[model samples]
Target: MKGKNIRLLRYAVQYWFLLFCIYIGYRFYLFVRHFETGGVSPFVSRPPSVEGFLPIAGFMSFKYFVLTGIIEPIHPAALFLFMAAVAVSLFFKKGFCGWICPVGTVSQSLWMAGERITGRNFRLPRWVDIPLRAVKYLAMGFFLVMIGLIIRTSMMVLFFITDYYKIVDVRTMKFFTEMSTATAVFLVVVGLMSIFYKNVWCRYLCPYGALLELVSKLSPARIRRNKKACINCGSCSKHCPALIDVQHSESVSSAECFGCLTCVSYCKGEGALQMTVKIPKKGIRSVRPVFYVVALLIVFYSFVFVAKVTNHWASGVSYQEYMKLLSKQGPTQREHPRLP
Candidate 1:
């Protein structure tokens, strides 16, 4: 397939996933509204996909599951979704961010628009860029250490049952809907920076992206350059959203290579740059852009499929529990819980 077609398909996929996420979010809002409105509004099903936003909860559940061989029932989907993301990075080189993450899609759209409006996105100098990139890693390390030390293995399942943890998703939802002035300002600044620089939040601030990027470094599939077929037009490097120098590099070893294949799509020669997997005996088998995207979908959904079949996808939060918890968080209740 032509690179142009691949890129076009990529846009379609990105927008479609973004829309789906919006749908999930809207449904979740309605679900919460039923409790808030004292059943005056119609009830909507609480979407399990909303658990995707609860990554901190997901990370904790995942650690608990790994150590105890028991899945916390409160937010089982969080662990599964988190596992799926890590699994995607493990096999497909952070394609989750490139293909599925709504944040990445929004970031890409902002930067692309900025490029068209400003004639080009500005690249930070090496010294500045390198240190900024380290910010995400440092943040990731800090959380990993803190969460590790604070939540011991013995306290894992117990922590999940706490009222604070049970209501965390609600807390997260309120965090966005009821953002403080500082958070609002910070987001605005990040959005403007994303306009001027490529993926400013993902590149410099998102610890989740940092974790995925680190895991993607181990992916067997990678974009390799065939220098002999290169025309040296530097199109690959110029178009790279991650700012990777694809023209000079033999293989994309950078953690920033997120399997977008923007480099491959822009390359002049068919074989000049390719995302390929090294075979056991056979030579490295090149992956088509179409196949790469399809494989990503398959890998992701396969995890979802297994989770569903094994009853790991839904939250164990019963309707009564949600009503009890969310009502206390609703308009009627104050900070203190009312006695029945």
Candidate 2:
């Protein structure tokens, strides 16, 4: 008999989280509106969850924290959120991508809609697919070089202290509210492409996902196959959103595995596929989907709760600072004093 499938439960969790994210976005909009209107509107305090959208800023905060042993005051919530993501990857192997990320949820929804309409999603030939998948890694490499290498230590400190960094959240808010023609077109194209291909942006262009994949290589929890009980069936591979060939491998160690457990859910053969940990000489240990889900939530929210208790969840910038910065009309007017 097949094990109890958790795919529906996973969907429930994804949609629940997505709804919470949408609420955060709306709350943030009101907060920014209060500033943009010069306090004419009723004030809504900014939600710390808005920092989740600032991944690039979070990356900087993470590096600065590592080097200086301080979480920078500008976007401290970003650092906490970033650390939570890394922790999830360390223990659960990109479970954040599968369970929590709004972008991933959107991508999954688009592809599922496509499958419903067209009967199935399509895969590229290996020659084309292999190169396309490298695009995310290449993008990750570019950021690593730009932030990790080229930007010197003193410059990073100065950059964080600048007025521009102080109001980056406002700038980000404007970017989405005032989307340009080019950005609109790019999103449209990506959306349409996702109809035919599974997770087009995630599979080929998400630098964040790429970084998680690298970190998750060290994760102990993995999908293991029982060859002794195996009937050669390709169900696992067929259901895999990441296109991993789970049937052929003794252990699913691929960086592409997002820990969705679609493979484990689909396998009907007894003891054929399971999410488990295998230590040398210690033997294999099975892990349930619910356990992974609970673990991920605990790690992520625990960090957030600690940050709140420590008063690091909110930005240090004051309301007066936000008014002075956002009063400027456009990007050109809001340029940092230090920028050329």
Per-candidate clashes come to: 0, 0
lDDT digits (tens) for residues 186-259 of candidate 2: 99999999999999998999999999999999998899999987787889998899999888999999988888
For residues 1-340, write the lDDT of model 1, one tens digit per residue. Answer: 7889878988898899899999999988888887776555777877888888988788888888878798888888888888889988988898889888899999999999999999999988999999999999999998798677777987766777888887787788899999999999999999999999999998999999999998998898899999889999999999998888999999988888878888888989768999998777897899988988899889888878988899888778776677777774444432322211
The lDDT per prediction is: 0.86, 0.85
Residue clash pairs of candidate 2: none
Cα deviation in Å at residue 151, candidate 2? 1.6
Candidate 1 residue pairs that clash? none
Estimated TM-score per prediction?
0.94, 0.93
Weakest lDDT window of 10 consecutive positions for candidate 1? 331-340
**Model 1 TM-score relative to the real fold:** 0.94
